[model samples]
Target: MRKIVTVADDADLAHLVDLIDMLPGPDTRSFWGEGSNSIGSKVGHRLREILSGRGDSSDVDYLAIYVLKYLGRGNRHIPEDRITANLRGASGLPAAGHAWVEDATRTAFTLVTRYSLPVWNGAHRTRGSAWLQG
Candidate 1:
């Protein structure tokens, strides 16, 4: 079985939800829930382009890095050297790979979303996260 890496702690998710709600514009954030749209993939793809020098690094903020590094598999993807090569292959700088690899290495490991799923009959999971915070 594979392990998911989302913030299963209620307190943590609560804090995160509060923080995500504070973002200024609709296009800048991905607040996900029933009606909340989870456009994180767009941000990821855009960031990959900017990281490859294809676009600007405007949204490369601390919070983004924090989530990507700790909660998700950000640092584990694309090596420094491969960035340029991958950029070349991508032909316009999309996410280097659908799955992240051990930076600079051709070998790719499985890269799951790390997002927590509803568990324990939804009691434990729902209690830990609040979609209403946003």
Candidate 2:
């Protein structure tokens, strides 16, 4: 089954690379494109590989994919609580420190709350919120 459920533009994909890289964990081991030596490119390549189910994945991969799905769905701000809940329920995510779920959540929270670049707070449309207008 396809793990990636959303489509993100190039800018969004770059932002996601930043988000995933800021998380403290094992580095991405996949080889990227020729002459693409930047860390962001490697991470982005790894993410695509995971999404396509063509490479080995870890708990961190699952966490990143879930966050990507949330972002691509037009969520301006990602709730740490919700991400935590989803990570806990995700299959194959080991309940251990090495899983890196906590680290990913912390990084994502910091990015959205402190920097406020990738995730901004505004009157953005959310799922099932259209009822409020009716």
Candidate 3:
């Protein structure tokens, strides 16, 4: 007869939940929960509930990293070198006085909101090279 064993420890999960609890609420000055009604916040809140075993795991893996980083895990998906290069490129744009500053702000916002989150979340799991090409 053969015995089957399962690695049933959920210590990492529980620790993750505890870390989530320590995160500041949306009203805090440093809160990164996004807008009250934004999809990001909804996903984040739902992830917390799911990790705590209070909700279902419908989209757990997809949204896990986004909220997990707030718990001090940092982003393991996106390489630090890529992030630094992107920021450096953006910062190097020529400053045509105040208009250039405005353009740079918009560019930074677009990159952070669109490229950074998607890449970090593994949305381009097979096309990581594509993100680097941008």
Higher-TM-score candidate of 1 and 3: 3
Give the number of the best model, judged by TM-score.
3
Angstrom error of the Cα, residue 37, model 2: value is 9.6
State the C-alpha lDDT per candidate: 0.33, 0.41, 0.39
List where candidate 1 sits over 4 angstroms from the true fold. Answer: 5-8, 26-64, 67-134
| Least well predicted 10-residue stretch by lDDT in candidate 1 | 104-113
| Whole-model lDDT, model 2 | 0.41
Report the C-alpha displacement of residue 108, candidate 3, in angstroms.
26
Supply the global lDDT for candidate 1. 0.33
Question: Mind giving the per-residue lDDT tens digits that candidate 3 earns over 1-134?
Answer: 42221112233333443433433344543334346754337546665555455543323333443443322123443223322332322442333222322333333333234424654668746655777875
Model 1 pairs whose backbones collide: 79-103, 79-104
TM-score between candidate 1 and the true structure: 0.21
TM-score of each: 0.21, 0.24, 0.33
Q: Note the clash tally of each candidate.
A: 2, 0, 0
Predicted model with the maximum lDDT: 2
